[model samples]
Target: MTTLNACFRGQLGDFQLDFEFSIPSRGVTALFGPSGCGKTTLLRCIAGLNFLPEGKLEVDGEIWQNGKQFMPTHKRPIGYVFQEPGLFAHLNVKRNLTYGRRRAGIKSSNDNELHELTGLLGIDHLLERDIHALSGGEKQRVAIARALLMKPRLLLMDEPLSALDQDNKNEILPYLEQLHSHLEIPVIYVTHDRREVERLADHLLLLKEGSIIAKGEIGELLTRPDLPFGRAQDAVTVLDGQVRHYDARYGLSTLQIEGGTLEVPDQLGPTGVYKRLRIASTDVSLSHQEALNTTILNRLPAVIWKILPTDGPSLNILLRIGNMGEGSPLLASVTRKSVEQMALKEGQQVYAQIKGASLLGSSSTTQPRAHCMTPLIACE
Candidate 1:
C-alpha cells in the first residue's frame, strides 16, 4: 500500500496554495475544484516543481520534502502530464517514447512492457511521423504513453484533457478508462471537469481557493449539500447500479437501483453485473407521485432528505434513495424551483425524474466492499 501523509503551505505573488489530504494506500485520488483554485499549485508542490513556504511532502512511505529535505524535481519518481501535450518536435515519436521507456525497465520487465504500451496507445503506426503532424488527441495519447513508460509509482496529471476539443477528448477518454481499469500505479488526477472525476476517481479530495474544502469517496462527496462547489454546473449525483436486464426490443437497460428500477440509454452492458451511472442535477424533475407513461423511463419511489435553494430559478435537492441491494443510501439532485413548487419536504414521498446518465465499468459497477479508501495527512 502507498500513502501520501504530508502537508504543504505556500504563498505565491497573488495566489496561495494551502491544502492537506492523504491518498489511499492505492487507487486514483482526484483533486477537483474550479479554475485557479489551487489544484495545479498543489500538484506542482507535490512534484517538487514548486516549493511551498512551509511544506512537507511524502509518497509511498518515503519523505520527499520536509522543510530541510527538499527533493529536486528530477530526483522524484513521478510522471507529470501537463494540461497540454508538451511533445518535442525535433524528435520522432519512437524516439520520444524510448526516452521514458528506458527508465521503466528499472521497475518492469522490458521486452513486454514496451510492446504492450505501444499497442495500448495505438500510436505504433505513427511512430515514424513528426510530432507536429499529430492531432491534439494523438499528441496527448503519446504524452500519456511517454509518462507511463517511466514506470512511476505515482502519476500526476494536471488537466490533461482540458486543452483538447470534444472530438479529441472522445478520442482519448477510452485510453484513460483502460489505464484506470488495468494499471496498478497510483494516480493523482487534477481536473475541473466533473465528468472526468466521475469516470475515473476512486477517492476524491475536493479543493476550494487555497484550501481543502472537503474529501471523501467520489459518490459521497458529490451528494454533500453543504459543499460550496455542490451546486455548480458540474454538480451531479453518483449511483452504482447493476444491469439486471437489458430490453433490447425497446432499446432500454433495466438498471436495478436500491429505491427502484431506472431505464437509461442502451449502450451499457449485458455486463453480467452492473454499471456505475452519473445523473446530472438538471436532468432530474420532482413529482408528487410516481410519473406516469411518458418518454422518461425512471419513476422510482423516493424520500426528500434536504433541499438547497441555489438561486432564484433552480434549487439543489438531495434525496435519500433506497438501494435495491445491501448498502448505504444513494443521492440524487433536483432543482430548487421544483422543490418549492411541489412543496417537497423531508419524509415526503415523491417521484424523481431522471434524464442523462454515463455508464461505467465492465464488471461489478461498484467498489468490492464499500465504495473506496483514501490516505490521510496528519498536520499539526
Candidate 2:
C-alpha cells in the first residue's frame, strides 16, 4: 500500500514538536487540533518551507528530505492552498488557474482535465471573472483548481474555508467532496473543526501541543472510547449509505446502510444519492430488549463489541450489527448507572436507539471500509 512517512523533531519559538506518523497516499488526511497546536507549522515542514535538519519526509517511495539532503519548496511536487485564496488581484480566474501549470512547465493540449476540474469545483462559469470580483468561496474554489492544475503528487490545504462565512462554507464543501471523488492524490487538510474533519477526512491525525495524540480512520477514532474525541458530547459516527426510499408526504428519506435502514429528513436529495450520515453518540440510547411502542425511528439490533470507560460518569460502548467486521460501528454514550441497570457487557446483545433528527447528512463519495489504516506514531 502507498503511504507518506514523516518524522520531524523541531522547535518553533516556545512550541516543541517531536513525532512521526504515516498516512495513506490517497484521500484526505486531516491534521486536526486546537489553535496553537503546530498544524500549520507541520504542514510547512512537509512543504520544505520550514527546513528542519532532523526532519525526514517521504511520499510513496521518493525521499524528499532526510538529514543533510533536502528538496527546495518550489522543487517539491506539492500544491499548497492557504486560508486565503491569495490570487493575483489583476488576473482573471482563467489566468489564475493556468498560472500554476505554466510555472510548472507542464504542457497539456487537452482541456479535458481543466474542464473536469472546473466543473467539479463549480467554477466553470467563474473562469472569466476577475479574481477581485469573486466571493470568498468562489476565490477558494479557484485556488483549489489552480493547485490541482499543477499536477502535484501531494496537495496541502490550510483551512481553505476558515475565512468564509457559513453560507460560503456550505457552497464550497460540495466542491471539495467532488475533489475527494475525482482525485487520487493524497491531501493533507489542516483544520480545527470536527465537522469538517467528519465530512472530508478518510484518515485522521489528532495533534495536540505539537505532539500526536492519536491517528487512525475517522470512524474508528471517533468510536475508540479511549480517545477524548470519541467521548465528547458532540462525538458522532459517520455511516455511509445510499438513498433507498423517499417519502414525500411525510418528508422523510430512508438510507440503506450496511446493517439497517436509516430514515433522515427528506430534503437530503433524490433517491440513490450517496451520503455520509452523522449519528451523535449522545443521541443514541441503549436497551436490553427492543421496544415496540417507542417513538424512535431507527432501532438496530447490535451486539456489544467493547465498552470503554470515560473520564466521567458516562461510558462509551461500541456496538456491532450484522457481520461484526462489516457493520458500521455505532457508538452509544450511556451513563455508568445505565450500564449496571442493563447488565451490558462485551459480547452481550443490545438494541441501539437513534433519533431521526440526530442523523446529519453530508457529501460522501467513498465506500465504507472495514477500518481505517493509519499507522500510529509514538510520541516522547
TM per candidate: 0.84, 0.87
Tens digit per residue, CA lDDT, model 1, 232-331 = 6546777767677777788888777666777876747665455667777777776776667777777666667667656445667677664222332334
List candidate 2 segments past 4 Å from native: 242-274, 295-297, 305-316, 322-326, 335-340, 345-347, 357-366, 369-371, 374-380
Best by TM-score: 2
Model 1 CA RMSD to the hidden true structure, in angstroms:
3.6
Give lDDT tens digits, candidate 2, residues 1-380. Answer: 54688888877668788758887768888999999888999999999998777788887788898866999999998889999989999889998888878878999998898988899889999888987789899999999999989988899999999999999999998788877866778899999988998888878889989998888887777787677776675567887677778888989889888777888875676677677778878788988788889888788888888888766788888887653435778888899999998889998878889974343334544344223565433223
Count clashes in each candidate, considering only residues at least 3 apart in sequence or on different chains.
11, 0
Q: Mark the regions of model 1 whose C-alpha exceeds 4 Å error after superposition.
A: 10-15, 103-111, 233-235, 256-261, 270-274, 291-295, 323-341, 355-375
Task: Tell me the whole-model lDDT of each prediction, alpha carbons only.
Answer: 0.73, 0.81
